[model samples]
Target: MYAVIRVRGRTGIKKNIADNLNMLNLTRISHATVIPETPSYDGMLQKGKDYITWGEISEDTLKELISVRGRLPGDKRVTDEYVKENTDYDSVDALATAIFNQETTMKDAGLKPIFRLNPPRKGYEGTKKPYTEGGSLGYRSENINELIEKMI
Candidate 1:
């Protein structure tokens, strides 16, 4: 049973975490993080002044992480019909949990709650499928490759 927590942050006080936590659903941070220096993209670059932004989370990297994990072993979230169908990948938190609750876990990386779904036998089997005969070992071995690929 995955605990689904609804997240609501402030663009007012929490604007710094806007991107990283945007897709997640958590009302409050399990823990708080603070840092001094914010990295500037213009530093050492032959360019004009730009917003020296810094905090956790990046859209490109996050997408890459999810895609990478989806293709790796032990990560079966890729097979999630819920994820595959949706054009926009929601945060890995309860937002996705409402779709298929195969035991989700909450992650506190910022003010937002990120989530990763627990793979069914190492992947998604849609929530309705006779993928195995009462969850047997032989049944799993027979579908192991499918399970691995689908999890991505």
Candidate 2:
């Protein structure tokens, strides 16, 4: 799965990008959402590329994210036994693997689709430019996990 994090806010954003962000369910700063890796999602990410950063999420990071930020229905924390009883997966990693493979989504696992995160402790270099330009937008591949860790 891919993790998409909103880098910028909703001021001065164009209509199309705003709509794309809404479809991605990222209306707040420091919010994140996991989506399957597919052509449709690829286009959505690109549509909001200027306002977000995305990348392939690692299994370890997925586990950490779920343990720390994942919330069940009614805002409960996700526990190992809860995952086992509520879903077929035995562990967070297994569920993450399944989601990574597009067998299930965050919804299927009984977890909240949106992850509310803290702004990176050190702050971003710039939200106006791409990752390759020493900024915080666009794709960062495995480095996205590093960013998530800081925010978590």
Best by lDDT: 2
lDDT of 2 by residue, 62-141 (tens): 87888899888898988889989989999877887787777888987889999989999899879999999999999999
Q: How much lDDT does candidate 1 score?
A: 0.28
| Best-performing candidate as measured by TM-score | 2
Clashing pairs in 2: none
Residue 70 lDDT in model 1? 25
Model 1, residue 97: distance off in Å is 16
Per-residue CA lDDT of candidate 1, range 14-98, in tens?
Answer: 4534433332232242211112122332121112101111123322333333444422234345434444354233543333333
| Stretch of 10 with least lDDT, candidate 2 | 92-101
Candidate 1, which segments miss by more than 4 Å at Cα? Answer: 1-55, 70-75, 79-82, 85-152
Compute the lDDT of residue 85 as modeled in candidate 1.
51
| Cα TM-score per model | 0.19, 0.93
